[model samples]
Target chain A: MDGTRDIEALIEMMARLPGLGPRSARRAVLQMIRKRGQLLAPLAEQMSKVAATARECLRCGNVCTSDLCEICLSDKRATGEICVVQDVGDLWAMERGGAFAGRYHVLGGTLSALDDIGPEDLRIPQLVTRVREEGVSEVILALNATVDGQTTAHYIADQLEGQVRLTSLAQGVPIGGELDYLDDGTISAALRARKSI
Target chain B: MDGTRDIEALIEMMARLPGLGPRSARRAVLQMIRKRGQLLAPLAEQMSKVAATARECLRCGNVCTSDLCEICLSDKRATGEICVVQDVGDLWAMERGGAFAGRYHVLGGTLSALDDIGPEDLRIPQLVTRVREEGVSEVILALNATVDGQTTAHYIADQLEGQVRLTSLAQGVPIGGELDYLDDGTISAALRARKSI
Candidate 1:
């Protein structure tokens, strides 16, 4: 209302973003307009490029500019071990750790009873096919520690029970966690997994 | 990144916005991608249009698509009283308040000695010309309550000492403010401006 119709429309659209409300969107739009050459022009160009080139990897569900993502194409990541995650974000997290030398399988989301999500809605069937066809020896479930994540993990494990070896990431306190701050569930899990040093 | 180069670039650009960080930018981009036709495509188009059309009013320093802003062109707002503000944002704030019937003159920014900003850097010269030409009887300095805002207001007041009636927004406790929570300056200002009941 304070600017041109086009500017107002842009602000309205920006306000629909996850983090920005109307007020923040207005501020952002104003800044962009003020610094058009420095920020707005490049951002608009990048967004257009992403809208045109970005696509999901056919094999693993990760986003890529081509048919297959970089990780899916890399021979180094073909360790006959597949790390199954709930989303591409989780797959990236695992990659950032620099420990896993295997490829990834993104489920898109976990099976949720309340949300009416099931195996068919996810990459469960594709995961099964990959395990059998790609000579996968291990299937690591690196899902979140939520209820739906656990249920999906169990479902996947049951499906691949005799077909392939299945495992999941452990649940415990974080690396920089304080003992006093640890929840009862974590404390119990830590105690149960305790080993003599 | 979890996504392609194009998508990563878009997210990086979004992260530079005022309210959004990298994490929130990722979320926003993901949502936009999911609703490409309904949201992302339209938003991109609108941004492009805004980038091309948005301009500042040469007379009042307000954002516009043409030579004059909406307020500057509207005959309904010519109340012979000019509400002076620090920026278009402050002008918008006044409009949202719905108390003023007069038109506005956006100053672009307050006079900042630290930034070496002076009256020439703002619309002070244009404001003087407008007052003389429009037969303006009153000039309201609806500037911010900050030190720079007050300093700018005093400077303007000195320039137009006898040209027109000068006033400012009252400094006092807000409508729903608690006395215990208010600072000493605000409390003192409120006490000094207390009305007879």
Candidate 2:
């Protein structure tokens, strides 16, 4: 109502953001308005700039402003190790930790037969090509601990079985989390992935 | 740490987002890269368009693209009711619900002695002027439930005590929430605001 149409439009757009809804979107918009100069303006400017320049690395399937992504072009990054992940969110998680000096291979999505998903739908073929072309020696599957995620990981591992070394993230207690509160799947995974201490 | 300086810069900027840290920022970047045409391009276009046009509503503190926000120019929205909030987020939240049929007044921030914020620092003066100039009969305080928020609300109430009818959101359980899981403050507020059966 009133002259809130623009604000409303903003809220609608923000609602589409991950982990936000109409309520949170509205709150975020209001905060942006209140801090027009400090927070909102800078954010808007940066967002626009990135929007204009953003493009994918044609070879590595990584985000970049140019034809080649940072990972693909970086000569220092370990060429023999390729960390595979289910989604971009997972890739980002890896980057935040500042670990894994190797380059990444993002499998856009996991194999979901129920949803009619296949290897072609994901970047499975591209991943295989990258392995051979880049002379990868190790392939680390960092998929989520979900059913579909594990299934996809197994499928990838089977495909690359004789070609390279396959490994996964260590399962057990999360660094800042408790074990008693762990779900059935986590508990089972932890038990199965028990390492030699 | 890679060749895509622009992408790195974008990721760094994105990491500063409210809920997104470095990790989430990375995943988001990767996703945008993989879905270059469907999700990334359109999002980038919209971001640029909004960045070019976005501005604060001179009258009501809402965000808009024009000199006069759509709400302030609409003749049908002169409902004499003004919803006053501590931030633009609250205003946007209200707009998202698409319920309230009145205008909004954004008070940049709440009065906070700890942070050295005072009435002059906020838009209290503008609010007073708007009340008198806009023929407003009622003012709704939609500030947060925090100590600073309440303090600011009381201050506003005292300022316009004799001039206009003032009300606030009813305190109670939120929709689709378990009362037992609510904090003590919420429970107390709900108890104190109990209505006659």
Candidate 3:
């Protein structure tokens, strides 16, 4: 083997990450080597620690070190409103807004016809169980604007209709979105959903 | 600690890498946790192994597990020609082209007047010593097309004037680069360096 085999292997593994390609992986590996004490050691340690303990929260499908997520255990979050999202990343995005004080249900992914993924493939059944078991009053579907995402939201909406107050995020112009840059569908939706100021 | 604290820490660390930001890092961490046995465990194990053994080559400053890098140790590489680059990443790029059979000398960084970086800050002195001692005949400066990079290359050339045959990469229009989008300076340079191809 080459003398740099191990280092090359490390770089290859890092390149397989979602956002990093070979070029950035090489830079990252070099940077890690440069700051071994401050970044590499701690990162390596944390990765191992997290790899050992991290798992899907049994209650909400959020990543956690235990069976139940922090939001599920914390009584402070509003139990009446459950924001359902397609992925944990979406759940985190909502948390970053700092305005959503309610708990979440991560669906892992949306329904994909091409991939043959359906309700059973995601955490839809678990979400329905949570809605009934937790006395949830509002089931807000915060899925993406994608076709598959809308289909999944509609399916979930149908599941919980008449049982509780069901709602989905409004389809309209986003905050600070420019009208000139918006697509025809978005512009039409925004016009249709126009509100009095 | 919260149940998701460890997972969050892992995401934070992943985000600090070159390509990944907060959102992508969260997604990458979640994927890693999901594929722990297949990807995460192997990656962590490989990183730890490399972190323990990785070091810079004494001769060329290339990352390696031994005193000399693989390129330095290889008998097939030309000893008379040394491709000088500002960073190890640049050296790797040249290698990816599969044309350069010469050894390399990594300067680590360029001479930056604003950053107070001078020849002494880089591996310039060691390079001079290597040229004198290693029976080198050519030094090809493959520095970036940046102000600091040009200044560093000029400084190194001045230091080794008449001692060796110094050359640099051609600066002109990139292959497949649209002429319409080309900057004025680049267009002028390409005109000036017009070839018979």
Candidate 4:
């Protein structure tokens, strides 16, 4: 118990992470101590490096080491299209899918009237400016299927209406998703948007 | 993506911790980055401190900053009774229970014939020396009920049979455990060890 105080403080800080709790944090700290040279030192070094350098992209709100993110700076990504997302996590998810070859505009959060968050609070204004200034011909709303996500998408659509071809991700039974497990709203939407083969 | 390489490395290291996977690690890293000043920086500082200070207590094999653990140095603990456990985690578990006021002897691990682990591989010789020199009256083998745990317990018992009183933990229905949910082995043990009201 001589050094438990410092270890306990480390556990407490680790417990504040998204997926870790007190018990897991304690185990993690113990393991880190056990592999101090291999894990703890390198992890601490990486965390410090990230804390010192990591910043949001000025253009698209993506996390980056510089003023602009890699995706925002890359000339290979299509300038004609801009995909709108709720946050950096969503942008990463889209990139992992590897379907889209365009630039992304991370809104940082949804429009929540209950929480008093407005369009201006998000990156909506920045998105509109990008659409106009960058000669974007299409704007894709790839926001989540939540109520707040839909509301935010609708607001962005209104902001950029007629200026570009506004589109949204199609809602239906996901590939490999079971019809029996599908929700009523999804079933209804899928039925209404049915296309003939 | 520019800063993601460092972030990904952090995630990989985090995923190596017990009870965490790659997805959870990614989520944790993102949350930490988002709260860099409040969480990431402090966590890094704590980790570095722990890494620099934490070491195994020479006397008890418990993690501590000094040469001996707090419990080993405490005069309040009953040196007459030695509770032998499998590892530091098991010692911590017993400490959490707060039932035994005696000091602990951590064996580190059980004797595994398949793994070529013997008495020399564990702290058995040190435990024997403590029992002889410390004037210990009782030696409690509070080891796990696994085959290897019982094997190690029996081995230790053989070494210290004539010198001190030897005992092991009772095996029966756990507190708040239901008979319907209990295993046959436990039910049989409980019946055999039944006491008179």
Candidate 5:
């Protein structure tokens, strides 16, 4: 690992990913070698491009390649509803289902008192501001079912009570099920059966 | 969605991510708008830097910031054992465990007759060459438990059955469990109990 600190560094970075590690990183590097032309080159190109240009949506906490995320700028998305999630991955998961018609508000993460995470730590204040400024009629809490996540949902609910229609994803999502792990059917079911918190 | 071609182009690109759709891409774009400094700017900067330098390892099939991967160049890793895997993600998973003190060979993909994928379609030929030249003593087939994976492993066994010790991860892994999903303990357990193929 001495000569290729660059590769090691890449692996190290990859290891920090949600489900990767050093050994897996090494194997991945090797596979990238063989498919350099097809997969590796394109992935690297995109990764770099994203790394250089990718940014969180200033309005909603989503990742984008631009200054303003498209949903915030689009006139058509003014449906007066905001679906809040814990991470971009959850937002992506919701998108893959293609069931929701309104805009989104990514929380970046949930409130965790143990972690010293609070509303400010997430995007709660920003969400509150958006509800008032953007004329949102509803706020959908699409966060995970984790303890911290529920705490966050409750906090947001308390902050937005009587200001808008407040709801949470229904019972389709199993306990401890991250949005990332839920199937399209489950997400759709949860969204359909959404209940007021 | 139509203002800046470059930005729209970026959303289009992002839409192609594994889980992201056009709608999510749009929402993602909007979020980037609000947090240009805190998230978007930094992500873009990092993407640019990675894009400029990211390359695949010449010796192994891993993605690297240079031609040679750190593991391939490491003297300590030259333990004559080559753990073979089917994807870069799997490699990264193994790496996260922080075990295994050998080199690696990324097959890029498994032999899939249904998809018309064969040994030549993957990095099998290169793997054979590596074994011959690298004086590899053991070959751990860390491929998935799928039929295609087993087929590929068998094919490789035929090619180098007598040349090196052949082993495979034990059958504890779920049938369709991608290495990406397995926790560190399961992966380590599989590695430790790997049986001779």
Candidate 6:
């Protein structure tokens, strides 16, 4: 325990991460110490580098090490369509899917009246400007299915009404999802939007 | 994802930790980026410090930032009872219980015939020298109940049989353990060592 204060502090910090607890943090720190050259030193350097450079993309609020994100900088992604999502995590998820070929607009968070979050708090004003100035034809609301997400989508749709086509991701049972395991809401949504083969 | 190469590498390194996977690592990195000033920078600094300073205690093999650990330096811990554990983690676990007032000897690992590990591979030679030179009266074999742990404990006992008193931790059903949920081996051990109420 003596002279282990720094290691203990490191464990405490690791425990504050999203999924780790005290036991796991202690294990991780011990392992890092064991693999100091291969893991601990490199990790510290990488973290410091990221901490110094990581910033939000000025155009879409996505995390990047520069003024603009890769998607926002790519001319190929300027396909007259802008996908609006609640957070940078959602943007990353959409990118992982690789179906969308257009640029994105990260709102940072949904408009929550209870939390006093409005369009101004998110990047809604920037998104509206992008849609108008960039000659966007379609504005897709890829926000979550939560109530606040829907409210934010409606607000965005109202802002761009008649000027551009407004749409949202289809609500349905996911691919390979068992009907028995799905909620009633998903089943109903899937049934209502059923298509003939 | 272009500017996220450093961040992605950080996540990959984090995923190598014992209890974390890629998804959890990604989530942790995102949170750290969000709380960059409060968590990321401080954690990086602490890890670098630990990496630069942490070393094995010369006396007991416990991790510390000095040649001797706190317990080795403390005169009060010279109680003539040395608790021999398989690893520093186990020693920390005993310290957490706050029952033991004596010193500790971390063996680093159990002797394994299959892995070709012998007394020399662990700190057995050092432990023997410590017992002979430190005027120790009692040595508690606090190794695990595994086959290799028992083998190592027996080997140490044979080495110090005539020199000092030898003992081991009691085996039984854990506190608050129910008979129905307990394993047969543990139940039998508890019954064999049953104490009168």
Top-scoring candidate (lDDT): 6
Task: Report the lDDT tens digits of candidate 6 across residue range A20-124.
Answer: 999989889888887889998999998998899898889988889999988888999989999999977888899999999999998988998899998899988
What is model 5's interface RMSD?
Answer: 6.5
Q: Against the true structure, candidate 1 has what lDDT?
A: 0.87
For candidate 6, state the interface root-mean-square deviation in angstroms to 1 decimal: 1.4
Q: A1-95 in candidate 1: lDDT tens per residue?
A: 44476787888899988788999999999888877777787777777767777778899988787889898899989899999999877876787
Interface C-alpha RMSD after superposing true interface residues, each candidate, one decimal: 2.3, 3.9, 1.5, 1.4, 6.5, 1.4
State residue A159's C-alpha deviation in candidate 1, in Å: 2.0
Per-candidate TM equals 0.92, 0.75, 0.93, 0.92, 0.53, 0.92
How much does each candidate deviate from the true structure in C-alpha RMSD?
2.4, 4.4, 2.1, 2.2, 9.4, 2.3
lDDT (0 to 1) per candidate = 0.87, 0.75, 0.87, 0.89, 0.73, 0.91
The list of candidate 2 runs beyond 4 A from truth reads A1-7, A35-53, A65-70, A73-81, A88-104, A127-138, A161-197, B1-3, B65-68, B79-81, B92-103, B131-146, B161-197
Report the lDDT tens digits of candidate 4 across residue range A1-197: 63788887888899889888987887887788878899998899888888888888899898889998888888999668899998888888898999999999989899998999998899898998898899999999999999999999999988888999999999998999999999999999999999999
- Give per-residue CA lDDT, model 5, range B2-76, as digits (tens): 333455565675455444567666665445544545544544444434445666677778766667877887899
CAPRI accuracy category, model 4:
medium
Q: DockQ numbers for every candidate? A: 0.56, 0.28, 0.65, 0.70, 0.11, 0.70
How high is the DockQ of candidate 4?
0.70
Q: Is the docking of candidate 1 incorrect, acceptable, medium or high quality?
A: medium
lDDT value, candidate 5, whole model: 0.73
Model 6 docking grade: medium
Candidate 2, A1-197: lDDT as tens digits = 32345455666765665555676566655555545566556655655555567765677666667888677778888668999987656776788798888988878788998999999988898989988888899999999888999999999998898999999998887888788788877788888988898
Residue pairs with backbone atoms closer than 3 Å in model 6 (clashes): none
What TM-score does the predicted chain A of each candidate obtain versus native chain A? Answer: 0.94, 0.89, 0.94, 0.95, 0.81, 0.94
| Native A-B interface contacts kept, per candidate | 0.58, 0.22, 0.61, 0.76, 0.06, 0.77
